[model samples]
Target chain A: MDINTVNSLSYEDFVQVFGNVVEKCPLISAAVWSRRPFTGLSDIEANIAEFIDSLPRSGQEGILRCHPDLAGKDLQSGTLTRESNEEQSQAGMTALDSVEISRMRHLNSEYKKRFGFPFVICARMNDKEAILRQLSERLTNERETELERAIDEVKKICRLRLYNLVLSDTQNKL
Target chain B: MDINTVNSLSYEDFVQVFGNVVEKCPLISAAVWSRRPFTGLSDIEANIAEFIDSLPRSGQEGILRCHPDLAGKDLQSGTLTRESNEEQSQAGMTALDSVEISRMRHLNSEYKKRFGFPFVICARMNDKEAILRQLSERLTNERETELERAIDEVKKICRLRLYNLVLSDTQNKL
Candidate 1:
């Protein structure tokens, strides 16, 4: 779909098409539905990012909490969305040895205890080893930076998901 | 990071840890290197329905042909490495409008013209709108009595240099 096609969509249809890009946060897309007539994908993206940034710290935490933990039980239980399932697998979480899964589970529990939300990252954008390394290092950071960083990661994930949702052809040439 | 210490890896080192999942693809991780281990997440997934009920074909075509289209260019550019990239992104491809890419060009040209490989149907496992509707239709296929039906889709794609890969974790559950 092109800019005009989007421009022509009803609010409900638009939300239905893009609601899950933020991972169960359909309200974001719902809120964004009225701000149509987007100049292009970037304008639309910037608006969504700004909307997320405008949220209070608690609201941002809510967004962060919405994501499932890497290698968490939600993954094996089939609770994740197609986007989430695919992203986790791309990061190579699909075939962990029983031993690796247990280690990740431990780290996930520890991180949530300290951070108040799941550790957020764009898994489609990285590999398993890289994801693990960051998981370890972020544990020592001060709360403020980690919180800001997770939001930033969420934005990136949104961008990719949006691209997949409506703009792959026009995505600035590969 | 193992059960004892994914929590301990330096970001850079942890990245080196879970980078590769598919035994055959290494460049996927290498290409994703600068992207950072993603200060917050291990993910790795690939799909190639391993129904190898027979021996090797052209042997050379076996390797080059294993990959699916990466937005359809990796086949031409020779860049698909992460086995999961092809398959996870496969759903994203389903929505690309016919004008954005032709259906037959979309069908994958080189793969069929040269080699006799079949593009296997794991679409049954995916959730994209386009994937599901096509599933029950394919189920009508006489896979055993007409092994020929399976080969037909394969021959159609070879003309495009052929196509695509990925696995899902909770996919086993669904």
Candidate 2:
């Protein structure tokens, strides 16, 4: 759908259209859908960032938990929400060799076990090695700091996803 | 949702409720939802079986492609739609140790390279070792035979998933 089509869609229709663009946190799209005719991607990104940041810490955590652990269980079955499947695969993380896969599995489990949710990252921004390094390094973080960091990563992910969506819509229009 | 409630859901709602219940083929739920007010699980299964079998060869192939490779990348990211994640993990494929992981990776690539889609099986009914054994063994089948075998496996998966969904709904009522 193009920008005008997106802006004109009913809330429910818009949600169905843009909802999973940012993975499981569809509410972000719902919240921002009314601010239609976004001049471009920046308008959409700013509002989404603000909306997510404005959520209660617990709400933020809930959205964070909605994302899967990096290189975790979703790939084995091709069940990642459409956006996540594309982003992870694009970064080459989905097809990790055994050693990298093992390392990822351990770090993901330990991170979740310690922090109470899966690790989150902007798959579009980082390759497997960077993701692995950060996953290992972040394990030592205190809960509060890590939570903030994860939310920040989610913002980056949402930004990239929105950019891609709008860009795709624009291209399709042409 | 129970069978009765399932009978009442609009086709889209039913699809949302049970679409990926068969992994990636939401259309299966859409196809079967109208034949509802099922007398029992078997009735539902028979209809789903008929719908899938009635499809053209390409339609069958499309649904088959929706499923991920066993022990494939979907596992690493915790991205399997909820039903598939549970099934694969239940059979111990999601938590494979290093050696099994590597073996699965190789087998999955080989199978897909030969057959053109993921190698799928009903993980809930078999242990990971059995899955691995079958994966290795199935690699040598002629393409036509392997496609038939994969569809048979998908039927088994759909049956178990439907049973689990109905059973869970039944239990929830009690």
Candidate 3:
């Protein structure tokens, strides 16, 4: 659906279709439905970003907690949400060897133990190599810096999801 | 879809269709797909139960954690999975007033603090009253007993979900 189609959706339908744009945080979409008559997808994105940004620190952390660990149990068991599965697949996450998988899991566990949330990257925007490299590098950052960086990655993932849904056929870019 | 239709689904399609039968624990469905050519839906149910029973304590707890709290944030914000939304609605969860909602939230929080997982119930089988009562009562149980009880509730929820998906038309039941 394009911008007009998106703008025309009823509240229930809007949430149903766009509910997962922010991963498992469909509350973001549910809240943003009230900000309808969006100028375009970016307006929708802006509304979502604003909603996410406005959350308190605990609320922000809750969003990160909702995300599954990349190439973790969910991926191994064929249990990632459809959106997550597709994003991970695009990043070659599904092709990780046993050693790579174990390393990713170990890094993800350490990251969570330190920050209380997973190491989230925009998997669609980066390959497995970059994901591993960044995971290792980011592990050294302070908690505040890592939180900001992770939320930025969330916004990037949200942007890509919105673009794919609303402008898949168009040449328009975010 | 009927049992024949269910049995014939490709592995990916099978997992996609039944992934959330045990709430967010799609791994159960993914594992059970390998035991296909089922005699009927009960066979599918049996396989799912077997797989769940096979999990270690931590894995079982992980399944419970996958569930959102009843009348919780996801419910209020329209963020529940379609199945969860329907199940909760069937149990009058969406109609909870602010006072009742707060009580449920408070109880859920306390229960989680006690057990480290959300209080899960077969919302399809019980209205808000029963759920509230059980949550209050179950809070007194030992951790081991509560874990077993919670897993039983998960199985009930799974059976109901499976029945709804595969036998929505016929009077034949689980």
Q: Which lDDT tens digits does candidate 2 get at residues B22-82?
A: 5655545554654667766778788777766765454455456666666676777777778
Q: Which window of 10 residues has the lowest lDDT sum in candidate 2 chain A?
A: A165-174
Best-fitting candidate, scored by lDDT: 3
Q: Which of the two candidates, 1 or 2, achieves a greater lDDT against the reference? A: 2
- State which docking tier applies to candidate 3: incorrect
Q: Fnat of the models, one by one?
A: 0.00, 0.00, 0.00
Residue range with the least summed lDDT across 10 consecutive positions in model 1 chain A:
A165-174
Instruction: Please list the C-alpha lDDT of all candidates, in the order they appear.
Output: 0.55, 0.72, 0.80
Winner by TM-score: 3
lDDT of 2 by residue, A78-158 (tens): 777878888889888868999999988998888867876679999888888888989999999999999999989988888
The sequence of per-residue lDDT tens digits that candidate 1 reaches over residues A15-132 is 5687777776665665565467788777778877876776545556656766778888678898888999999998898988888888788888789778767788899888887888
Which CAPRI level is candidate 2? Answer: incorrect
* Candidates sorted on DockQ, descending: 3, 2, 1
> How does candidate 3 score on lDDT?
0.80
Which runs of model 3 end up more than 4 angstroms from their true locations?
A169-174, B1-174
Model 2 spans with C-alpha error above 4 angstroms? A1-174, B170-174
Model 3: per-residue lDDT, tens digit, B105-171? 8998889778867798899889889999999999999999999999899999999898888777675
